[model samples]
Target chain A: MAEMRREWIVNAVLAMALLIVPLVALWINEPFYVTLATRVAILALAGVGLNLALGLGGMVSFGHAAYFGLGGYVAGIMAHHAFTGLPMWIGVTGSNQMLWIWLWAALLSGFLALIIGALSLRTSGIFFIMITLAFAQMIFYFTLSWPAYGGEDGLPIFVRNQFPGLNTMRPWDMFILSYGVLMLALVFFAMLRAARFGAALMAIRQNPDRAAAVGISPFGVKLAAFVLSGMITGLAGAMMADLTRFVSPAMIAWQMSGELIVIIILGGVGRLFGPVAGAAILVAFEVIFGGITEHWQFFLGLILLGVVLFARGGLIGLLAGRARHG
Target chain B: MSVALFAEQLLNGVQFGLMLFLMAAGLTLVFGVMGLINLAHGSLYMIGAFVCAAAAAAFGSFWLGLIAGLAAAAAAGALIELTVIRRLYDRDHLDQVLATFALILILSEGVRMIFGPFPLYLSVPDLLRGTVDLGITRYSLYRLALIGIGIAVAIGLWLLIAKTRLGIQIRAGESDREMIAALGVNIRWLYTVVFALGAALAGMAGALVGAIQSVQVGMGEPVLILAFVVIVIGGIGSIKGAMVGALLVGVIDTMGRFLLPRIFAAFLDPAQAMGVGAALASMLIYLLMALVLILRPRGLFPAHG
Candidate 1:
């Protein structure tokens, strides 16, 4: 119990640091730092979504970028139509309401995940990795050639979308909105992990055959987890689009998917606060290394290789101690 | 399409397929023998292209550049295997993926740093520069030569694998690594040799393809994705499957791009059809992969122990 408390304290301190660092920047008149913090929150949320599948469910999807991109496109397409005073479908005019946008993003991404997960879950291991990647590539090519939106050029929102009770155009307000969503996601993730479903998901991950022997359907559990994972990631994607006020095929690129995986591994897979720490570290590295050299990626690669080889547990593991499972 | 254009496209598809085969063959071999997912395999391809480009420019001979590229790639592959990859053999797939992915970032940026951001071009050799008059149409002599080279390599590989002691050891290692190691074969050296051989094939593909496309940093990523799709459709660790899957993907991709727009034009207004058809055509190979997976979860030609 004492150890658990310490871990919670660590989580609290990590989340508080995320909130405080940006607020301090706001106090000192550095709005750019606030935006960067918002990016961390949004990216962390995406990482959390992936961790549910990869860390808990043991489905290493190399195509979550498809969901992320889809969510971004949903936001972008909606905002585009709204700005142009056009209806999207059957007199449903586009609106910049964040709530409506999130709902649609979740619904669409959930649907896409259902279709994709049903097919992808049929295969396992390396085949699963390749299939997910191929599916993402399918979405990527489709977007690259689609002329209606911006195609390869991507679509941009001139102004940030309005959030209820917040003027999201302000950098601070945007940061708060993203940070709040991330908090909500973390709470939900905690609840899910404690739930019976989460146990079933983890069971499937450890041993699918054994899980089946215990009266659990591994496929159904994994599929549910995958869909839920995609939905959360889609919401993060929507927020990301809002943060940048732009959506492009780059969001769905395999590289983006890889980054999300990196985030999970960097923090500690299956740990609740993993994504938060991972996101903070990644953004810090990007800011610091990027400021120093153009070849930061080369160094980032070395760091990542060292982490994978020498440090099985990531930032969370290093700071909070090894995850129970780890 | 006219008969001549159809024949020309058919030939083009085969040529493209053969290029993909070179990549897929090596990838499958590594996967089968090592059980490692080396994402940096594509980076080796980029290295090959860069080396070939620089060598050709310096020596004024494509042939010499090709040999240099192959040798350099093999050496790089072996060096990395000794330094990094040897440690990863017993690790999980995620570790392998991340480590290799890191290798890609380092290699790509390293090459970019040295070569500068601008793309370098490789000119075709004089002997293989012009067109060959086919009965239906004129085709690039270089492309025909590439096809010829690909076929010769494939045959040579078959012979090497079927007729050599090393090939027997490789087969044994794949089926029963512990037993083979117990038999006193130097497993470490065998792994290095297989890795280098695979790297050499990727180099050959890169050097050959460089003459057609500009040699550039990050040139290998798209081809890498396509090769993944090929290997998936072919079966993860099967050579015969790679060859068949490559041809299927190549031909389907080419034919879809060529015919889908026309087919859509007949159904929808021309402009809309063009846009929609192009979008779908671009995704044809992935769609085929999805279909194949739905039907054969283990791939069409899954290799057995």
Candidate 2:
């Protein structure tokens, strides 16, 4: 119980820091710092998405980038058509409303996850990892070859998508919107972790046979978790595309998927604020060490190796102690 | 397509498949024996290419470079096994994946630091350069040599695994690790040897391929993923499966790219057909993999049973 209280305090501090730092940057007129904070929030949201499956549900999906990239494409394609005043298909037109794009991004990625998860969940262990990877590669290659929307070059959104009463063109406004979504996602993640479904999902993750014996249908629970996980990550992708003002196949690359996993592991799997901490640390490392030398990734690799070998519990684990449950 | 064109494409497919087999064989061997999925296996491939390119340039001998590439990869593999991978054998797949991924960042950056950002060039040996006249059509001599080398390696691997005393120990180790150790077969040494052996094959493939393609940093990543796809389709830990899967992926991928656009053009406009067919062609191997998994979840050849 003491540990629980400590964790909550840590989470609260992390959340406040994420918001206040960006606000401070905006007040100081440092748009670059604001952009960096926005990146942390958005990436943390994506990490939160993966945390649902990886930490809580024990599905180490290596292909979350597929959903992330798919969401970006959704945002990019819609904004592209809206800007050009062109029809998307036959009767359908493009939408520049952030809300509509978010809905479609979530829905489409959720649907994709349904199919991929259904197929992938059939296998477990290393097979599951590779299959997820292969599926993501399938999407990556498709996007690379299909030249309609820039192909390998990628698509760009000339104007930021509109939000109600907010000029998203301003970096501060965009940071506010991103930060708000991240907070909502963190709340949703916390709620889901405490829900009946989360318990069943975590139960299945611990022991599938026992989970099945308890009449909780392992397949159904995992599939649902996977879909929800993909949807959250997808939402992050949409926001990321908007933040960058461009969408490319690089978004779907395997490295992006790897980075997402790295974030979850670095933050502390299953911990609520793990993603937020991981993203902040990762970005900080990139900026700090990157400024030092061209070969900063070498040091980054060494640190990650140390983390995997010695610090399995990640940053949160180091600070808050082992997870309360399991 | 004309018969000659078809024949040429088929040979290209075979050649590509053969190279893939070289990569998959080592990958499967490592997985079969160690139960470790080394993402850094691809880094070994890159090392082979870079070292071979550098050696060839220094010595002005492709043959010397090939040998040097193989030795360097094998040595690197053994070193990594002793320091990093040995610890990971008892760990779960997730840890193995991350550790090896970290190794990739380290190794790739290390190589870049030495080799700089630009790609290195490796020309084909004089003996393998130029075209050869087959009965049906002319083909690149270097490609034909690659096909020959691939077949030879496959046969040699089969013989080694089936006939040699070391092969018996390897088979035993795969089926029962503790048993082999208990039998005083020196399991630790065996693992290092196997890792080096696998790394050598990957390196050889990289060196050979480097002669044809530009040798650059991150070059092995695409091949690595494809090799993963190959091993998955072939069934993990099965060399025969790796060979078959490699061939299937290589042929289907090459032929799909070659034929899909023309097939689409039969009905759709050429421009649209080209775009659509190219997209589908790129996805064709993965679709094949998905279908295979649906039909046989454990892959075509489950190693255990």
Candidate 3:
């Protein structure tokens, strides 16, 4: 119980730090820092999505990037059609509205998750990992070869899509939007974690047979979690596309999937704010180390190796002590 | 396509499958023996190609480079097993995946730091450079040699597994790690040897394929994913499964690419067909994998069952 309070405190600090850093940067006319904070928020949203499945549900999906990339394509393709005044298949014209884009991204990725999870959840252990990866690679290659929306070159959003009231052209506004979504997702994750469904999901993760014996269908719970997870990540992907104003197959690459897992592991698996902390640290490392040398990834790799080998609890775990449940 | 072209494509598929077998063999063996999924296996492949390319350039002998590449990969494999992977044996798959993924980032960036970002080219040995004539078609001698080598390795592996004492221990280890240890087998040494052997195979494939494809920083990744597909289809931890799966994936993939565009051209406009064909062709093996999963959830051969 004390550990829980400590974790709450840590989460509060992380949230404040995320918001305050960007606000400070905005005050000082440092738009670069605001952009970095936005990257952290957007990536944290994606990581939070994966955490629902990976941390709580014990499905180590190595293909969440499929949804992420799908979401990006959703945004990119929609924006492209809107700009060109062309109808998307069946005369469905595109909308420049971010809300519409987010809804479609969530729905499309959720549907995709249903299909992929249905197939992938049929296998467990290493087979699940590989199958998920294979599915993502299929999508990645498809995007690379399909030239309608710019193919390997990727499609650029010449202008950021519109929100109802804010001017997203300003870096601070974009950060606010991303951070707002991230906070909402975090709250949703917290509520879910405390819910009956979350308990069943975690129970299934701990032991499938036991979970099934208790009248909880492991597959159903896992599949639901996977779809929800994919939807959240997909929403992040759409937001990421808006933040970067571009969408490419690289977003769907296996490395991105790996990185998402990395973020979760770095922050502390299953912890509510793990993704937030993980994203902050990862982006900070990228900016700081990336400035120091061309081979910043080498150092990043070394740090990750250290974390996996010795400090398995990750940054959140390190600060708040081992997880209460664990 | 003409009969000659078709025949040539068949051989190409077979050759590609054989190369995939080399990678899948190591991957499956490691999984079967240690129950560890090493994502850095591809990095070892990259290491093999880089070392072979560098050595061949320095020594002016492809044979010397091949030997060096094999040794480097094996040694690196042994080193990592001793240092890092040794710890992950008891951990969950997620840790193993993350640790190995980190290894890739380190190795890739380390290689980039040392070799720079540009790709290095490896030339086929003089003895295997030219084309060889068969009745149906002429093919590159090097490619034909690769097929021959793949066959030889498969046979050699079969004999080692079936007839040799180490093979007995390996088969035992796969079924029961604790039992093998209790039987007085130096399980630790056996694991190192197995890992090194697998690494050598991956390295050899890298060195061999490096001749055809440029030796680059991220070359092993695509092949690694393909190997994952092969092993998943074959049945994890089964060598025979790896062979069958590798051949199936390689042939299907190559044929898909070769035939799909032309097939689509018949129905769709030429340009649209080319684009659609290329996209579908790229996804062909993954589709095959999904089909295999649907039919045999545990793969063609379930190692445990």
Instruction: Kindly list the interface RMSD, in angstroms, of each predicted candidate in the order they appear.
Output: 0.8, 0.7, 0.6
* All candidates in order of DockQ, best leading: 3, 1, 2
Candidate 3 per-residue lDDT, tens place, B1-305, comes to: 79999998999999999999999999999999999998999999999999999999999999999999999999999999999999999999999999999999999998999899999999999999899899889999999999999999999999999999999999999999999899899999999999999999999999999999999998998899999999999999999999999999999999999999999999999999999999999999998998999999899987887
Q: CA lDDT of each candidate?
A: 0.91, 0.93, 0.95
- lDDT, model 2: 0.93
State the lDDT of candidate 2 residue by residue for A1-326, as single tens digits.
Answer: 77788888888888899888978888888899999999999999999999998889988899999999999999999999999999999979898999999999999999999999999999888888888988998999999999999999999999989999999999999999999999999899999989999999999988999999989999999999999999999999999999999999999999899999999989998999999999999999999999999999999899999999888988888888889645
Q: What is the TM-score of chain A alone in each candidate?
A: 0.98, 0.99, 0.99
Candidate 1 structure quality by residue, lDDT tens digits, B1-305: 78878877887888889989988888899889889887888888999999999999999999999999999899989998998999999997888888998999899999999989999999999999889899889888999998899899899888888889999988887788889999999999999999999889988899999999999988887788888999999888888899999899888888888889999999899989999999999999998888988898778899853
| Backbone clash count for every predicted candidate, in the order shown | 0, 0, 0
lDDT of 3 by residue, A29-52 (tens): 999999999999999999999999
TM-score of each: 0.98, 0.99, 0.99
Query: Per-prediction DockQ scores?
Result: 0.85, 0.83, 0.90
Query: Which of the numbered candidates is closest to the native, going by highest lDDT?
Result: 3
Pairs of colliding residues, candidate 1: none
Off by over 4 Å in 1: none
